[model samples]
Target: MPTSICKACARLMKEKEDFPRGNFDSDYCASCVDHKGNLKPRDIIRVNMIRYRVNNTGVSEEEAAEIVDNLMRSLPAWNKPKTPTT
Candidate 1:
């Protein structure tokens, strides 16, 4: 059996253990899937992971929200230039 790499984390995957989905084994690892038990865009996963970390810690709601906002800004989703569609 061949090993495949996770598109997100670059973790090695084994064929028997790996469940490939969406265009033949370009799938993310089980650990990389969304908390809701489904696939999500990479940016969403990145954002949610940070938010989940913030929530897990004993932080105040207002502080956590602020932190998460800053975290998202660090990813610069809004800073990227827009692409023109044909």
Candidate 2:
């Protein structure tokens, strides 16, 4: 069986797993994208979302920091990547 890594969140998935119909050549994993191939606003993948918000929004630095803080809180307490036990 071939394993695939999500382009956005780096989550591992089965390559033969069914992907939503569109995005014919897309390399993203289902958790990172929606049925329409749009990035999902999930805590598991909040890093890029926060960056995009801070860079593209008109909010002040303080507000941006607060937003980032919120996003940080949304993440699980232990987010370290999964590793196989020896």
lDDT string, candidate 2, 1-86, tens digits: 54555545444556545243433355566656776777666554565545556679976666866776664443332233633322
After superposing candidate 2 on the true structure, give the runs of residues whose Cα lies further than 4 Å from its correct spot.
Answer: 15-25, 41-44, 47-86
Which is the leading candidate under TM-score? 2
lDDT per residue for candidate 1 within 26-63, as digits (tens), equals 45656566545466666675555556657788676567
- Each prediction's total of clashing residue pairs, residues at least 3 apart in sequence or on different chains, is 0, 0
Model 1 per-residue lDDT at 47: 57
The lDDT per prediction is 0.53, 0.53
Q: Quote each prediction's TM-score.
A: 0.34, 0.35
RMSD in Å for all candidates: 8.1, 10.4
Q: Kindly provide the TM-score of model 1 when superposed on the true structure, using C-alpha atoms.
A: 0.34
Clashing pairs in 1: none
lDDT of 2 at 73: 47
